[model samples]
Target: MSLLLETLTTGDRITFICTGLLGLGVLALLSRPKVVAAEDGVTVTNLTTTRRLDWAQIVRVNLRSGDAWVHLDLSDGTSLPAMGIQPGIARDRAIADARALRALVEAHGTGHSAT
Candidate 1:
């Protein structure tokens, strides 16, 4: 009877541990950042990083080969690449965005950093 009780308790412990692990995994997934682009700006959120940028701060947009790259032009002619970029297949929309980005960069004096 004692051995049976011990076996049951061990099984219970294992179940408890597994349940806790599963719950933690779900929590992690739920905490992942959400990235969104708005009419005025871009927002990026994640477990470890959160960034937001306004339209005026954008330097340039480049669609190279199959990848879309964003260049943030700075006063010193350096640029920073913002997150939330998708790789490959940037055809029409990417080109349009790139043109808009170029216009913005030209307005800002043409110094930018590339990612």
Candidate 2:
């Protein structure tokens, strides 16, 4: 390792480090969680788990102030984070998306609450 480090110029070392960091950023972005709402249900895909909940199973959809993302309250007494409606960068768009999701729940879900 010492010999390899010695062989690399300062520019080469910086380039290697930057490349590694870029790779890690890309991997993190790719692995970020996602949520999709369909006619039948909502699908949430996180790093280690993927869950699908029917319209009836979701009790509420909320995107409160300062929240990083939208959250879904489920009938099973649990809440799931929805990464698709992130709160930074395109905040207006995220809010719009969250509203649209809430509308979907209200229209399709039986007696579900949304906010």
Candidate 3:
């Protein structure tokens, strides 16, 4: 409002603008996550990073009932969080996506499920 703008100092207005921009950037980043399945591998784009993984590298795909999103178990003995398959509001879609990704990992890589 005009009153609020009039009361704020120039530095305060600049700081407020920067903070709003940063918040928008964070929200954009949160919505930027996705999973891409290619011929050779899968690409997981999380909040702050993107990882390209070979089919063989992914040992398992886990999306349990209580889980908020899919987690990929890699052959390197590490688990990577895949936010692309989150089951928050779209639970069924997320489940299907997890299953499809799992099938791709199995058919293209080692048909091995977590033991």
Candidate 4:
């Protein structure tokens, strides 16, 4: 760390420090997407934004064979992409997560719930 700092000018050093801080600030946000289910609702943390949805608001959880991630069919007639249940590196886990979320939606949702 000292060797890297020693080679840079004062302005460059400041810039480097600022960049490092900025990079680390959003590191976790970029590294992992999450879907958390609680008694009240589900919280989905995507790449840059997070959304909270009540169980009744989610009509279905769709994760087709060729899909990259699960998608929620909402009561408001919009689809929300859930990147947390992606089938890229962990296909079995993703499928299991998708099934679990789907089961929750089916059990709790009342408005147009389906398989």
TM-score for all predictions?
Answer: 0.38, 0.73, 0.90, 0.78
**TM-score winner:** 3
For model 1, the stretches where C-alpha displacement exceeds 4 angstroms are 1-31, 61-115
**Best candidate, lDDT-wise?**
3
RMSD of each: 6.9, 5.0, 1.9, 2.7
Per-model tally of clashing residue pairs: 7, 0, 0, 0
Alpha-carbon shift of residue 105 in model 2 (angstroms): 0.8
Ranking by TM-score: 3, 4, 2, 1
Give per-residue lDDT, candidate 3, residue 60: 94
Which tens-of-lDDT digit does each residue in 9-81 have in candidate 2? 9999999999999999878876777888898998988766788889888878888888988889988899988
1-115: candidate 3 lDDT, tens digit per residue: 9998899999998999999999999999989889999999999999999999999999999988888789999999999989988899699899889889988999999836531
- Against the reference, the lDDT scores of all candidates come to 0.54, 0.83, 0.90, 0.84
Q: Estimate the lDDT of model 1.
A: 0.54
Model 1: per-residue lDDT, tens digit, 25-111?
988865664445566665555556676756555555544564544444544455554333434334565556556555545554333
- Kindly report which residue pairs in candidate 3 clash with one another: none
